[model samples]
Target: MDSSGWFMWALLSAVFAAMTAIFAKLGLEGVDSDFATLVRTAVILIMLAAIVLVLGKWRNPLQLGGRTWFFLVLSALATGASWLCYFRALQLGEASKVAPVDKLSLLLVAVFAFVFLGERPGAWSWFGIALVGAGVFILGLKR
Candidate 1:
């Protein structure tokens, strides 16, 4: 994908993420966190299956070796855990509060990317990270 395409995807992802927080908060009003997570995962699995079928990528999984399969399964498990924690947080706190705390992952990702991926952030990106950290602190102070 081109840089602009990647940028658009990131922007769209942020929008959807904000909407997800809102929806999760609303959905968890009377539901238990575990049940909500299971329902959400089921829906996501169905959607992902549809996308895989549409892109003819279902067969691509068959070509994976043992190590790749292990990592993929590990990643999926990690994602499920993160989703469950996120929904539980939403159920326990205000969306405005929980969402920003969840977004602290961006700072973690930046640090990990620099250390592992050898990807460096620009000065502006560093400034943005600082701002995000400050915002998270401010949000925490309200609790």
Candidate 2:
């Protein structure tokens, strides 16, 4: 729960996300997108349940209130939708291309945070966003 722990979690998440793209591309070689998504979701759910049980956090969900539950459900649905689209894209396009396009969501998130969360990123952050945009544009032009 400390800063280093959070950083490690973020790093691990990124690694796993990259691996997900590779594995998904392989898995979708001859599979329909929808069926691939279902299989992926089922496997992730089972893995998550095992982790929660092993960590003794199975009851953690019982601590959520109505608003938390609503948001959690909404987030899960959004995640599922993202996975569906990501897999579909992977099935139909190059992983390098699809991954960069998917990462554009970070720009969208930054804009949303600025508008809704009143977050004002400093000059460096804005520069980083500009660079990401440029990179995405260049990636798109590659094909």
- The TM-score values for the models, in the order shown, are 0.90, 0.90
Instruction: Pull out the clashing pairs in model 1.
Output: none
TM-score of 2: 0.90
lDDT at position 70, candidate 1 = 99
Of candidate 2, the 10-residue stretch with the lowest lDDT total is 1-10
lDDT (Cα) of model 2? 0.88
Question: Per-residue alpha-carbon lDDT of model 1 for 11-48, expressed as tens digits?
Answer: 89999999999988989988999899999989998999
Local error of candidate 2 at residue 56 (angstroms)? 0.6
Which residue ranges in model 1 land beyond 4 Å of their true spot? 1-4
Model 1's TM-score against the true structure: 0.90
